[model samples]
Target chain A: MVDVPQLVEQARQGRPRAVARLISLVEGAAPELREVMATLAPLTGGAYVVGLTGSPGVGKSTTTSALVTAYRKVGKRVGVLAVDPSSPFSGGALLGDRVRMSEHASDPGVYIRSMATRGHLGGLAWAAPQAIRVLDAAGCDVILVETVGVGQSEVEIASQADTSVVLLAPGMGDGIQAAKAGILEIGDVYVVNKADRDGADATARELNHMLGLGESRAPGDWRPPIVKTVAARGEGIDEVVEALEKHRAWMEERGVLARRRLARAAREVETIAVTALRSRIGDLSGDRHLDALAERIVAGDTDPYRAADELVEGLTNGA
Target chain B: MVDVPQLVEQARQGRPRAVARLISLVEGAAPELREVMATLAPLTGGAYVVGLTGSPGVGKSTTTSALVTAYRKVGKRVGVLAVDPSSPFSGGALLGDRVRMSEHASDPGVYIRSMATRGHLGGLAWAAPQAIRVLDAAGCDVILVETVGVGQSEVEIASQADTSVVLLAPGMGDGIQAAKAGILEIGDVYVVNKADRDGADATARELNHMLGLGESRAPGDWRPPIVKTVAARGEGIDEVVEALEKHRAWMEERGVLARRRLARAAREVETIAVTALRSRIGDLSGDRHLDALAERIVAGDTDPYRAADELVEGLTNGA
Candidate 1:
């Protein structure tokens, strides 16, 4: 008996509590999700999404705070979603991260939420896209999707952004490690954070070298530019922002942005359908339907592939 | 044309090349996968799956090598699948890991294959289960599935294991860190590798103390035991193996093994169905049918959720 219109109205007005509640509903897979999305749909596509990701301890939080400050200076409303599946950082380092970003805590123009995707069925793969939708519809002018860790999460986060920023620190080793980890592939703008350190120039040089070695770009193709920033002091952030703007412009001019949005739309639709199908499977799995199939497989009466087809067929036909 | 039964037959004989080819077919989503799996299904259920995972530098490779040697000494044919996402470590560190156990590398009783799940759709998440089936069908008495990195991959690996061994080392901080990472929840048996290092006993004591604080076990409930080992020296590996065997026996006696296998079967079938549906969506999404829906979304004609339903409905009904 939730009033979807009222909640959507409040979220459109940038009420933090309403926005949080909307996200919770999305996370919980509430029955009213599609209706809610439909209400919020027309209001979206305004916010500029920037995804920041890198290895742990690479000053991602500091950089995010600096970028928030920079954007707020221009009078832009901001939303931040910090995704951490490891969950350790969410408690302590998160507190420290917020403490540093607390200057804007009461601004109301800024919204911040931490997402721990562990132990959840859809995890970040599903919840993040919906969360982004909520933020976009809530009238945030700019949304920052930040992810931590060195694994596939980086690529996944980068895929969600209109512009992706990959940050690295000096003395954390060379750009070769980042290349090896596939960070280089996703970066739209590379930042050498903590640039005051001794190896900053070296790190920047290494990154430039690697960027040069990439599948030889045509003359007009956008090469990921390296920006040097000591995010702690908020130095050189303008250059980072400039690079993001450049990439956005490039994507738009090439009609890549339109295609990207179309692809994102298609992907989101597919995911929603898949998630609904999975839920159907879960519901049908009750009452021993799935248990019977599993028992047959365990008894060697049928293989899993044939059994899966049977289950899918049974569920589809009955529905 | 693919000879599914012949390939499965060669794989069942424990031929390494045939095993590699079978896994490749699975990774590539070969058209004959269902047939191949059907042929191999009856030959499975004999191998004991042990999943080894932890944070980097915790000596998982060494511990796995030690376990392999211990099992080999007892005349068990072992299948080792090292899941390195990029396939880099399998050649270098894998050799180092097997240095002590190299004596058995030349023995026909041992089978080792490294799985690089990167660049494949669903990657290790989907491919590992099928590869485990291959190893299981190949008549390996014990199959060790080893994975690297932290985060979602850890949980996926744990789900595939009958026995999940979470390896740790001294100076990696306290059990609190592991608990924070959700590792403590899924571990069937805990091993503190590099026991010769300083604070080894302290690490063990801390782990034991933490394990004691977990949900109180009944008189017969299996509590995960902490075993200390200098894996490089192969010290205490026998104890680790003993603990694994004891846990297996306890699970069997309590009928948990049957329940676990049944659950595994159900999950595998569900994953296969979901994967198949996803491929169907991927195929249907091509040719701008999805693009038209996305254009409507971009133009605010509809929301993504509704568009997804339309796409799913069109595909499902047409099929």
Candidate 2:
């Protein structure tokens, strides 16, 4: 049996393996997850979470590695959680991404882990926050949560952060694509990565134009700033970091950071509650109550809404 | 106010505008949806739902159009629900896809509607089945559900169909990509579209090899068959239709069709139930009960699971 208290102590001392184990428990929905979270809760609320998200091939991993280097140079312990919600089969693509971030793999002050949702019920919604908590309790000064692709789940994950960084690359159809993916609204700091490539200036210009088109901010409102960087060559990364810090400061001054964290906590709680309820509903199917309702619906004797009402009634009545 | 009975009557008589209006109501989650669904419950179960899905640039739209023509040739009334889950902006790309399908716009026997989730809470899960119900009640003998992109939502939407058709194109990196996207396990019919292109045979061979590597089927189990086609020119569509029919026959023979329908109905009911519960949970946040819990969690006084447990307990006790 795993020693939960011992594991928590090891993680708090910055033992990477214990942190990984806690995250794995969260990913697997292991029975001991509740205890782990309870033990870690008091130690969390310390790490500053910055979520980086963009389309594939947009240099997210490289930028993440660069950010790790930048943060470590300042003597801050950093944690990286690379989340892949797209792939169901875990570890393959995650391993490749970890390899790309291998320079930091051997650094004792840096903790890096790759997580795949593996077709979990809530995908990253249920897993990422807990993993972030683990990192936060592991004495990390900063945690970078990076997602692989631009999808609804990825956007949702990015929005959970205190500061969300949306990345784009030149000639990638990213300006309008970002809007369509709903990332434009969620970005606190936007990065035009691969800034040395052709049309870099145009991409940044178009992005600025697009971002300005729907502006309704007051004079003192926090406007999201765009940073240009060549993440591969580690060029302009410090500027990107500065933009992030400025955004963080703005959020802190406005009390937006506390509000965002509270909202994130609310969402995490709601997701867990819903997932628990769903598992109970799944149990109803095993007992043929749901099956009976389904048969009635399929036979046209009833509709799904009425059937759903019955299920909810049973659930709320402690069935 | 709309007349639900009259509208359902018009749809039963196959009036295209009535069908469109009913679908609009479903998409909008109109308050009268329960009444409409109750009225249409007995009228459904006639359409054979075939879901076509693949990555972008895999000729999904072309293959879907060709399949419509093939089914129409046999005098089958068809309904097409082109779902774009990836695009939150909606309408622009959906309109483009509709123009691609304009050749059937004037045909009274054909009903084509493009639906976008618009970032709805349950997304396509909540909308697609209800839309499918509308099309089925409108007297479509065959209904086609085509989703844009290869993502988790698209896979889910495809799986809701009676027979899921997974499309692929040569040189699309689709052989292994299929397995990674979790589409291989959900496909009831496989189509390699753009067959005239280079590496078509290699794609097919590689897909076959991958499909065979995980074989654990019994003697009478239905093996998913791969059909090659150049959908733009309408080549090999008849064979695709034949494969679909054979699979449908196999399912009916084993009573799998009825069972699949029952399972689908069960899922629909469960989603509706969960969505209703989620809305109630949302209400809790508005009243600050959830906010209090969230504050406690953020303050490290409690973990999310414990907070969620309290929330669920209140909900079950008629909170």
Candidate 3:
């Protein structure tokens, strides 16, 4: 058995392998995860998490890499969690992005890991926060979470971050698409990537117009800022970082940062609790208690509500 | 307050308004949901649920309409639940599809309702099953659950059905797309709709090849049949229906139907229990108990697991 304290100590000392192993424990739901989490708990809360989400071809990975470079320039320790919710196979969708991110592979100050949903019950909802915890405890000053696709999981992961960045490219009809994906509300910083492409100005204007359309914000409320960039060439990346810092400062000034972190922590706790309860329910199925209840429900002898109530009662009382 | 029993009774008599009201209650999570579900429980288990799912532009609504007509011609009362998981606003995305289903709207024997997720915590996972229960108890012979999009929720809804029909259209790269969507395993029957179009045969061939690639089924295993259909003209629908019946018969012969229903009921009960527990957790937030725990977690005084354990313990014991 791996020593949880030793592993966590190594991770906290900027050992990438230890950090990766801890995240592996999180992803695989390893037996030592609870111990690992406890060991790292007091060491966390230093990393600022920024979530980047967009449709494929919006240059999420490029932007993420560029952000890493910018953060590293300030001598800040960085971590990247490239989450691909669509791929059942971990690392498959991120293979090319991994190659692009090789520039930071040799940098001990940078830690990067790719995660997929892997058909987990809650998908990223349960896993991402734990993975983020791993990075935060590993002494990373800033963590960038870049997720592909605009699906429900992406929206969910975005909201869990300390700051959310919604990325879009020109000529993709992304302004309306962003609204449709429900990311517009979660995004604190929006990047119009591929700014060198045609329709860049048009897209930015349209996004600005739409972002303004639905509103009643107080004078002091933080309005999400839009930044334009050609992430491929690292152009306008500093401005992107600037925008992120400004948003972070604004959140801190208004006490939103602490509130967001508290909310995020609550959600994380809830997810873990729910997952544990679900597994207990799964155990009931293995013992045929759930099966028997389900059989009665199928037989119309009891309603699902009543059967569920009994099940919940048994669980609560039995525990 | 509306009388739950009266509404359920009217619903049982095949009153469309009563059916719609019950579904609305399910969507809104009305206070009388438990009573309504109890009254409807004995009346359910009769409707054979057929879940049809695919990407947009695949003529799902058209095929569903055709199926409704076919079922009605055989003197079978039909219910159609057009679920749009992508749409946050209820019935917004399905408005056009509802208009197309107007023919059945005039027929009292047929009940059609468009349901969007409405941003519920579990989205369709919590609502769809309840709505299906409502439809099943309303004396429908078969309930067609047509959901748009190939997201996780769609895959989930498809698996919940007694028989899942995955729709694909020619020239849409649908065969590969279907496999990528993870619907390949959930489908009991696959329909290559718009069979009159070019590449229909190719799509079917590719789909067949892909379906066979990773399988080593026993002799008696039910192989999902792929049916070609021009649903707009109602062509090849009978064969689709026949395929469905054959699959159903196969499932029944092997007792798979009972097992599937039992498993589905188990899931439904679990979802309800989990949702209830989640609300209790939400209540903890209002009481600032969860906030205190979250604050501890954010302050790095405790890990999420231990905090979650305390929260769960409080919930179980307090209840």
Candidate 4:
């Protein structure tokens, strides 16, 4: 017996070790995950998920640390999940983020976890929403999911957040890349950190310019406001929080917040379903069936499309 | 009839216009892809696939174009598939590569095509294999798949090629990053492009040291030899080509070449099958089924894991 109910209760009581153990179950994709999720499901959905993303070296960790401090000042329990999807050297990079935020470690109200691929289930992003549910159930008033802004991974991260904050630094060429990578579209609030540096105002101007050319949201669509900060010194964080709160209010008023939560739940179910199907695809029967089709296709007896049809058919039939 | 057979014939006759149209079909992911893949299956396995990859701005395009020229000098027809897996900014960046290689555009013996997304389906890498098959059937002696080695996309690129070349530039701090990203493992040949740069040798030395610690292949396994090159000036290309040739021969000798092709084909088939399953997940009767599950999960009537099971089951049960 894994004692999911007891652990969930302990987690609700803000026991750090219990929270860590529960998240570890999510990371490990242990068999008991179903029970844990079932146990924690009713208690979730209260915490606000704010996603912070930026190109590496853009001071995302520092900005996130600053945000945590500001939220703590409001007396809100905050949970931080720092996800590093780019590097397999995740341990070192994730450690750096943790060390930067370690000043808050003594406070039990702040629960910080750094996630890398403990095991590759497509990506660590896939496990994130589940871990988020744990934190949400554990009484965190806010949960921040921070990830390196890269290709497809960033899109997944944005999907998980209720309010997405796109961070940048002066002279990183991130403004133009942001427009190109479609980061501008996903962001609800933008921050140009390292505001003390030269070119900071220019970076803000450029991001604002790019946002101007972005897709026009519906008539009442929220405009993303860009704020500059020297996150190194925790300057401008209150404004960042203010913008986040404004966006949260806007999203909720527009029902976009509810839709986003629904979409997140939908994606979570889809990920699990797809993962199950994928795992089922590797059984001895399925492997042989797939290899047989592949052999025929390679031997020119059939094409990939038809073989795929047969394979999908096999999934429901004979084994 | 769309004259797919005639187009295939024209392409095989080495008509650049015809080859370009066929590759366009690949980029568009036209339904005729099945017919084309069946037609090209046997003709593939003739051309050698050399994957050239590195961090962007490391001159991967220059190296690839230089190799195209060297192969053409030997009177061998070559094909280049420039896969821009980065952002939408890929259009301009990839164009630069094509323009540089356009010097040979009139030769008729070289085929260069760039594949950027017409849409988002996570099928960017999937299209490359089919395109490679088209090039093989079109009588190219060598088909180079060039991609920006940023993250998981690079790994996918490596898996598609028979000989994977890892390119680096001095001062990119890429040597260590490469090790962290697991780039050091997939490479069959390594090149330090822009060897004339101040820190080139030091980069080479560091790469060699990392490679030294890398796992040894079988006793007779081919060691991925590191070669330095000034691709912009077309220097050291002959050695790069030689190393590629040597690796190809070694792979063939060890039967690794056959296994790799088999794996590639298997992956292609699996990608199609999985894509089919994924597509079946969110539409028609399936949409309602999933929404119902999602609603229940959101309401805590059931957990995501259980809802996922019901959804997967519903996928096979209904239309």
**Best prediction by lDDT:** 2
lDDT of 3 by residue, A1-319 (tens): 9899989989888888999999999888889988988887888889899999887678887888889999999999998888854321235546766677787988999998878654776678888888999999898999998876556776788878999998999998787667756777777888999999999999888888888834678888888888999987999999999999999899899999999999999888988888888887887778898999998999988988899898888778763
Which 10-residue window of candidate 1 chain A scores lowest in summed lDDT?
A: A84-93
Over the stretch A1-319, how does candidate 1's per-residue lDDT look in tens digits? 8899999899889899999899888877799887888887888888888988776667888898899899999998999887854322244476666677778677799888778755556557677777888998999998988876455654676666888888899997746557656777788888899999999999888878777745687887888888999998999998888898899999999988878787777777777778778877898788688899999888877888899888778766755
The C-alpha TM-scores of every prediction are: 0.92, 0.93, 0.93, 0.93
Provide the lDDT at A125 for model 3. 84
Residue A302 in candidate 3, Cα distance off native in Å: 0.4
What DockQ, on C-alphas, does every prediction get?
0.63, 0.74, 0.75, 0.56
**DockQ leader:** 3
Q: Write the per-residue lDDT of candidate 4 for residues B6-89, one digit (tens) a residue.
A: 999999988999898888776677877777777776666679999887776788878887898899999999998877544122
Q: A201-238 in candidate 2: lDDT tens per residue?
A: 99888988888934778876888888999887899899
Off by over 4 Å in 1: A85-91, A94-96, A150-154, A173-182, A213-216, B1-18, B86-89, B92-102, B173-181, B213-216
Candidate 1's displacement at residue B223, Å, is 1.3
Model 4 residue A225 CA deviation (Å) reads: 1.1
Instruction: For model 3, give the interface RMSD.
Output: 1.2
Tens digits of per-residue lDDT for model 2, B204-228: 8888887783477898799999999
> What CAPRI grade goes to candidate 1?
medium
Residue A222: error of model 1 in Å?
1.3
lDDT for model 1: 0.79
lDDT of every model, 2 decimals: 0.79, 0.86, 0.84, 0.79
TM-score of model 3 (CA atoms): 0.93
